[model samples]
Target chain A: MTRAELLADDPLWLILIKAVVLLLIGPLMTMFMVIFERKVVAWMQHRPGPNRVGPWGLLQSIADAIKLPFKEQIIPTTADRKVYFLAPIVSVIPSFLAFSVIPFGPQVSIFGEQTVLQLVDLPVGALVILACSSLGVYGIVLAGWASGSAYPLLGGLRSAAQVISYEIAMGLSIVGVILYSHSLSTGDIVDAQRDGWYFYLLIPSFVIYLISMVGETNRAPFDLPEAESELVGGFHTEYSSMKFAMFFLAEYTNMVIVSMFATTLFLGGYMAPWPISLIGDNYLNTGWWPVLWFMGKTMLLLFVFVWLRGTLPRMRYDQFMRLGWKVLVPVSLVWIVVIAGIRAFRNEPNISTSQILVFGGVALLVLIAVAMLIPDKRARAEDEYLVPVTGGGHPVPPLDLEVPKPPKRRSLSEAKVARKPAAVPAGQSTSDTPDKESE
Target chain B: MSAVLAAAAAEVSTGEAIAFWVLGPVALAGALGMIFARNAVHSALWLVLTMLSLGVMYMVQQAPFLGFVQIIVYTGAVMMLFLFVLMLVGRDSSDSVVEVLRGQRLWATVLGIGIAGLIVGAVSRSLTDVPVENLQQQNAGGANVNNLGKSIFTEYLFPFELTSALLITAAMGAMVLGYLNRHEKGMKRTQKELVEARFRGEYERPSPLPGPGVFATANSVATPALLPDGSVAPESLSRLIDSTASETFSDEIKSVAGTEPGPDAHALTPSTKDTSTTDTKNTEDTEETR
Candidate 1:
């Protein structure tokens, strides 16, 4: 049966069940992701993680969640109480919302009722996820603003900028996928990758998206908002106990959402790996099997997130932003154009094999030439504007650049006479005479 | 109008309507308390009440998600930050309001009236155009996370991505702004200098000769003589003179001191003839007595 026929047959109760399942999956996956990340990072760093909780600390997150609500709630005196209280809710809701459109499996029979293994699907499902994630920034921003503290506000602002920058690169990176699939629907995009994953065909876009997704989620190595050394817990600095826990939960859930999106778009959502696909006609691709495969791919992507967090240090805020705008955005844009060109050529009915090879060769050459040429312009511009000044008499000091030596201090007599009284007490005479003779 | 009034009356009982009336006033009180509380910290607490009431309103509107978000984000995290900043900056209860209204009281009144008028007009217009079908269809479940997610990832993907870019830029801008550079220009000056420069301007110069020796005499008579014990006796004498001179010198010095050189002028010149005569006379008297 066609995909449409299968979708049309789904009952209201089945849809509700799928939605509930999806909702539960987000928190559950987030819990596991947290524990898994800690354990893996600990392993990488040569330490044990969370072995005290139930069964090798598998239930640590559960313990945390249980403990959170009971902890004392502190409201900052200078904070906007309404906005401050609303920020974390804004954060977690969007995370859950973003996860809803992600397809977990193919149409599966449940309680003898046929239904898609998703809460609901829309033609613009991908855009919905993006919107939710974008809306998530308001929570951080408002939290910072409401807190009325410098650190939280700074963190909030950083989070906002981080999300906005990486989001563009992230979106651009997906343009290639959208072009290839010819649909914005997550399920359709996954279905389009049946023959081959876009990760292989659109390698640059895939790589760009992968990098941008990490930055977008404010994960480790990109979590400037929560840079402990700098922001003292970022936008949630004032948050205590349950409110803080919600933010933490929201962050992990967001990570899962992004990973699932990456899996659906580029890793072929719910499709079994190559070896498994080769073993049988359709054993692993049907029923509950596909769910396992889908989950496995998402977990793997999540593991990569943990690995990055463990291994890489957080980038400086400027460096993180520069990577998004200066590198990822341009690369994604170029790749999109290249993919579009290739797709147009592929669509031609009478295209020859030799002509295709020649076109491919030319495309590769053009890409190389463009890549080689682009940096020179940037370098020249940077060289020309080498002076590190912000220009309000408060110039940004040059990064790692040596400032010219200030004119040497004049001899004592020539030094400008300070107009104010000496900082030393008036009773203590400033005469240069030594008391040694009297002594 | 009669049918509508009858329907409204039928929908809510007197008790329910009374409860609504009570809640409306309470919510308004909470909002006013949030704004007008003397202590900033108290203001935040009052705001918490306001948010809680708003959340109830959201619940009434069948927007549980929005209501939950309202409480969680606004009351929980944002207010906590506000309180934290107040504490961190040491804003005590004793801190006086620096400027209650400044010059904006009239402007504020005008703006408030304008806003109230606009809101009333809008509410009247909205009441006239209220659609029963739209109100009935409002519970269509599109506001759920699932629907929201689908919409974001599909139709609004570009704008969503663009918004992320905007947020990232804003974050970057904030980081740049918040970066506390200890060595930033103008901040390098001493605290005293900064305060003086900021408040005093150039008005606080010291007098050129500020201390005791500037106008005082350098005479040997004024100077205390060292005794055989190596102690100076003249400090006590000067203290005695200082105590007596203010009262005694006013009448006597005014008449007699006008003829003689002034104390300051006499103190400056050398007393050659008087010193020599006094010394010779002292030696002659000692020889005669012996």
Candidate 2:
């Protein structure tokens, strides 16, 4: 459908149907995301995953969904009743709301009326998604706070720091897309990329967007807020049954939302890939085919999410913060400047690819020069702290920690020195000889 | 009269009208709660509610961008920082109890009432002039993101740029002030000294074992002693009883603490035997908590 037809008036029933579908997608995708993540990660680890629940474990997530609601709800006695109860609901609602603005396909006929394949699409479509994500953090922070526990509180604090740092990069990275597309609306972005996907042209922005999306969704490596190893269950440590399930569902829905956003912004939403579009004079790009392509792209990105989780270890919190603030943000800012310069230069009649190449080469050379001049303290520090791991000897964990150490083997002479001889009476004691004398 | 009657078309749907009424009051109540809540986290939660209400209000006004910005920036990021501070600093009642400024509460009440009265009076007088039709046309039509962007760039460019500069200056000022206080604890140490101090065994390492080590992983915080064969041996130095499942005396349980288990260790009895053991356990638990 053309851009003009996006906001065409729809019957109330159609709106309701669209809304219902939009809402259902979140829970359904969440269920699918859970099983998908487990299965994919299991495959990566060379293990069979949950195949017991149903045919090839297809019904596992569904079974989990059925089980979660029936589980006994637990509320900590120390928790503030109102806020504790509201946190998960608060978290789940924004996740659903954020999905509202993401367009799945072009205008289509629905019950005799022509409309978009998805729910409402705002002018500030991407921004609405960002807002919803930001709002979702409250559920987590509140959950941690109302639990009146320590680890959950730490998890909450980590989340606050993480989202704030990553969001700047996330927001700035999208700016490049807006500048290229000349519109904030998602549909406009897709239409703008009909000829070329932004993933190829805006490579740096795409890379940054990908990184930020991982961080934004709190997926593995960047999932410090819910890092099980560090904080037990993190912010949901005190949550149980349905409340915990809400948090769990919210996380997966976020994964889907972010994946879809990445697809829409960089991968060309709903548009079929190259060669596929070449089929039947571009029949693959039209009609209901676009929706299929949209889902296909999003699921592919979601697989990447699971792939990263299975392959990478969680980052140290400081490392994560540094990556977001020091690396991603500054790099994107410079790249954005370069992109803006390129865009403005392209508007000129005489600009050529050769001229842009010259500009890029010069920029690269300067960056290298600057990097060569800067002192690397971290490298030196790493060298200083490095220790040889020899003959089962290892660095000691803190006294409070419970690291196991094996007993040392002793030579014959050393064993004699180490073993204390049992206390021997100078003469036979009464108790020692009593049993024999009595017999 | 006809013009007024015909203007009903300009109004939002009945559902939206009801939502507005409900959300408005909820927002107001949230703001009030933020002011009067007992705990700091509760206050932050109330502030969140207020921010969400304001976001909905912006959406009602046909400005989705502003609404989203309200939710994303104010409710999402800002209040999260507030909650973080509250959670990290802990539930210190002294934050509310000890008034740093004398007569602060009285002056706050006065100023608050005066501002509320002024706002109510001003809004009551100006409410009639707001054209409802323009808002309806804006919402029902295409995205107003372009219009908002155009106005900000063209009409209010200077103010926008000026505000950003102002924010930068404030941030710089804060950093400078914070940096000035860094040396208040002591003279600044050399990098070498800082590194040495941080890495020193006493400062960096934990001093004593929490208990006889029953578990260890390379990634875990706990460190245990090892045999020549690289198998863990319990230290048998713990003052408190280890109650881990591995310490249970059942067939499935091994003596993780290196203590020989008695026959009665696996069973729970409610007579003299259980009570005497429970007495000792209660003492140990009390000591542990302390």
Candidate 3:
């Protein structure tokens, strides 16, 4: 269908229905994803996860959802009542809004009226997703600040920095896609990918986008905000019951949004896979089948997210920030330039495949040369703290160190034989232990 | 279907009118709230609301690109930075009363009012020409993003380039401001003095409140301890519950009063009042002398 045809207005009831479906789709997908994540992670770890809830624990998320409302809702006495109450709400709204622009399939007939499977498709569909995801940060930051607690505040601050660092890369990465598609609308971008996907054409942008979307959602490896072993529960430290559940829903829903966004941009969106499309002259890419393909691609991305969460360790706050700012941002920025140049070259008359190949080769060499040029970072023994020791502590754990083991069990007389004190066991250095050891 | 859609597009929808009224006031009220909110964080949040409402208003006006950018850049990133600054500076820090630049605030007010008047005049004149109805058609819509970009880069290239230069200059100015080091009033101390100040013996890492490990009380953070040395005391105000023991915080001290030799069966005191009093007075005097 043409762009004008795609922009056709549906009946008001149909529009409302689309919105309601979009709303319901997020929570349902979140519920499914939660179970899927748990099951997959458990399988990877060799354990049975929540099987008691239902058959193979398929309905565990539902049970959790049911439990959330009945549980006692807690608002800390010291918390800023209004901000605290609004924080989770702020987080969840954008996640739901993000789902609006994600194209599920092409136009379909519903109740004798034609409408697109997606909700609204604004001109800046991809940017809307980026915008919504960016807005989600406010919820986290506010939640942390309003908690009137220490760890949550730290978590919120981390989120602020995290979002700022990753979003530039995320936006830049999308620019490459937009340059290729020559359209900002998600539907148009998907439609353009019908002949050949941008996934292969814009490989670097896709990879950067993959990393960025992970960071954007604050998922594993890049999930510094709620680094459980460090900041307690991060921004949701003071939250409990339904309010806390909202944050949980927001997180999983963002995962879905980013994954769907990736599909829309790089994975040919609702188009069937190559093997399937090749059959019957691309028959499978039509009607409700497209929705299935779109969902399948999104699901695959979600699995990748889950897989990364299961496998990789959470990144240290500084390392995560450095990766985003010093690496991903600059790389994505450079990649956009490279893509734009390539586009300009392709547009020129009489350019051969060999010339394009040579250009790609040169680009690859340049990246490699740059990589080799930058000096390797040597580990610093002194600056080992995850976060720096700043004025007025915010309750983030300092650092883990190779503390000399305590002395072996011995008689009091044997212990007393050495001049070293009981507190300073044998083979342990006094100064090596951090102040936290005193606690 | 086409006819119905065309008719719907021609007439102003109730939803559109409602959204305009709803969002316009909220955006204006958000500005007012930003100025009046007591807490710094609350003020920042109000600014966020203003930016968000404006973004919504832009979307309502059919400028999706501008609307999303407004939300993403101004509300999302810039407001976040403002909050970061507020949080970092200590959340409880209030605005200073004393105007550092004399007459600057007054000049700023006057200039702001003059600018406001100019904008109002321009908008009012435009409104008279468009009659509000044609302004809807003047939307140019989401597709205008490409047109706008093309115009700026081609037709208005010089002005756009000038704007970029101005932005670069502003950025440099900000960097320079950051680079400038302002000296504080505190006199620099020697390494030895600094070390001495930091490592205060028996009071290392003082907590802001009375909490666990201060003294061996059953209830960790609650209640102050009374010393056996005839002192109603905690030696340090710090409540940081460290592994190290206090001189007074020992299990062997028995009870503060030796009148009851319950746990250890160790310090048997005289049942008679006179003898007990003498013994306690002698111990107190000895402690004082030491």
DockQ of each candidate relative to the true complex: 0.03, 0.26, 0.25
Task: Estimate candidate 3's RMSD in Å.
Answer: 11.0
Candidate 3 or 2, higher TM-score: 2
Give the per-residue lDDT of model 2 (tens digit) for A1-439: 4553444466678878888998899999998888999999899889989998989998999899989889988887888788889889988988898877787888777767888876665667888788888888888877877787888888888888888888889999999999999888787888899889999989988999899888887889899988999999899999988988999999999999999999999999998899798899988877788989999999999999999999999999989989998999999999889888878888988978898899889988999999999987764335554333335644333235565776676789987765644344555553433234434
- Candidate 2 runs further than 4 Å off: A1-6, A350-439, B1-19, B92-94, B102-125, B128-143, B180-290
TM-score of 3: 0.75
Q: Return the TM-score for each candidate structure.
A: 0.56, 0.76, 0.75
Give the fraction of native contacts in model 3.
0.44
**lDDT digits (tens) for residues A227-280 of candidate 1:** 999999888989998888888888888888888999998999888888898777
lDDT of each residue in A1-439, candidate 3, tens digit only: 5543544567778878888999998899989998999999999999998798779888899998999878998889989999999999999999998887888998778898777887776667888888999899899999999998899999999999998989998988999988888888898899999788989988989999999999988889888889899999999989999899999999999999999999999999999999999888888877789999999999999999999999999888878888988998888887888787877888988999898898789988999999999998974537433243345633333244345667577889876786555567666655633332333
* lDDT, candidate 1, B65-142, per-residue tens: 455556555654465556556544543446655658776767888999999999999999887986533222332322
Cα lDDT, all candidates: 0.71, 0.78, 0.80
Give the candidates in order of DockQ, highest first. Answer: 2, 3, 1
lDDT for A187 in candidate 2 is: 78
What's model 2's overall lDDT? 0.78
TM-score of chain A of 2: 0.84
lDDT of 2 at B243: 38
